[model samples]
Target: MSEIPPFEIIRASRRSISIQISKTYGLVVRAPFSVPEDIIHAFVDRKSDWIMKHLARHTEQRERKNNTLYYLGHIYPFEYNLLQKETVTHSGGMFTFSGKVKDSGMEQAALTRWYRKQAQIYLSERVYHFSWKHELKHRKIRITSAVTRWGSCNGHNDLNFPWRLLMAPKEIIDYVVVHELSHTVHKNHSKYFWNLVESIIPDWKAHRRYLKEEGWRYALPKF
Candidate 1:
């Protein structure tokens, strides 16, 4: 029989077996404490193909993220200078930084700070431009660190957008801005809500498709 791939097994007070794979943790299996070791082994065997596929994906994603950084629909070469300094700079298609970035954690934190600042400036401007053009009255705008959503509109009329949106093209950014602003008028995604979005940006569907297919690649690394 083929050897089962090495994985960490955590027996916890849980109801079922679960598996996870990531760049940091290669493969992990969580099972009920009462499950037999043989059963756990069998489960892993059954999931080996899935585990291998995800492991390969994680590996490729890590390599790509490490190699490049995306900003404003442009791919920039990320450069780090060991010399201590205060901020990151972008010029000539490169993001250069000279700071106390001794590790990947520090680098990711500094990059996130820079991206958030840019998002605050750029996204706020787009939101205002669209709101004024469409007569949408939103209470406030906030930049968020949300991973799953590009933007959201709460009951208070406040709009929140993920800082990672700065990495997408301006059209995609406008689509998200218009989407949330439309929420100020229509709380749900009824036909009217979609119609409102289309009125503002007729090509919103194309932007949505691009974001759906490619946006995840531009998410800030989790270090």
Candidate 2:
């Protein structure tokens, strides 16, 4: 018999027993009041292995989110700077910051402005490069501080991309640029739309998966 670690059990009106693993709470069991103590214990005992696995994962994720930063598809430890010419700069595989990078509203605003500036310059260049290579025409490139989406294409043929995307690797950034530009020709996600994306980026599927799975890293520290 496997030994289940310490856990908090909450009796509620829910229909089914559910297990949750949290960094703050460790293992938690939620069950309807109708479930007996023995039944709840047995259910949790059965899931002890899964509980341990997720606990470890949560610990790793928490440490990562606390101590590291992401840019260009790589994770780097943060180094504080008291004096520097730039508000933020990346060099030698690390990020050096001249001021408070977290827990401050001012720093968050600075980060947003810096990233949007970079996104405007980098995404625009990629858009122009691809547009010329494929003879795709578009009206303009716009950088946005969007939270819910990565990019959008409007009927005006203008493309909009989130500033947070600059945190991704160059290849992932290129994939998104190409994706929105593809909308210039096909507005919907038909086979023709994806086929065009695949034409430019043969491994487009991998990039899309990266964005879906790793998009959480593309955020500024909370103000």
Candidate 3:
């Protein structure tokens, strides 16, 4: 039998035991401080397969992030300059950051800020465009840092979209925008809601597939 991989345990004041694997920490098992060591070990044993799968995924994502220099649906080389003031510039298929980028964390932070700014401008514009084209009215639009979902619509008619969507192609971004705007009329994913989306974007299914299959490539490392 193969040896089980070792994992870190974090005992805290919590209700239940849970596991998390990320680039920063390979495998972390969190449990209530009162839980017995043997019970924790048993829980870990039961979840070992899931932990290994996520650990492998984390490793692969880290490797891919290391190889990627450009992001946001654009293939541009990222340039860094330590002598100049701390600012980011994009021009001529290049993104240049002039400032003290002390480490990978700082670099990721700078990129995240830039992505948010771009999302504010680009996503807002797209949302407005779609709303006007479809004669749809929405209370407001907000940018978010959600990891799992691309976009969401609340009962208040407020739409929230992840800044990461800027990393996808424009078509995919449009589909997400339309999907949320449709919620202003129909809150659920009923057949009428899908038909409404198809009316505006006939090929939304292809765009959705692209996001599902290729969106991970654009994921930035979590700081």
lDDT of each: 0.84, 0.81, 0.80
Cα-based TM-score, every candidate: 0.74, 0.80, 0.70
Candidate 2, 23-124: lDDT as tens digits? 678888999999998999999888878777677666657666534667667778766676634487767877666763334565566667877887888888
Q: Over the stretch 1-223, how does candidate 3's per-residue lDDT look in tens digits?
A: 3235787899899999998875666778899999998999888888777666666676766665533443557656566778546776787777776776546767777777888898889989998999998998998788889989999999999999988888887888899999999999999999999999999999988988888766776677533
Whichever of 2 and 3 has more lDDT, that candidate is: 2
Cα lDDT of model 1 by residue, 1-223, tens digit: 4344688998899999999885577888899989998999888888877676667667757786655788988777877778767567888879877776457777777888999999999988998898888899998889989989999999999999988889888888889999999999999999999999999899988988998767767776544
TM-score of 2: 0.80
Q: Which stretches of candidate 1 lie over 4 Å from their true place?
A: 1-60
Give the winner by lDDT. Answer: 1
**Residues forming the 10-long window of minimal summed lDDT in candidate 1:** 214-223
- Runs of candidate 3 with Cα error greater than 4 angstroms are 1-72, 221-223
**Candidate 3 minimal-lDDT segment of 10 residues:** 63-72
RMSD of 1: 4.6
Best by TM-score: 2
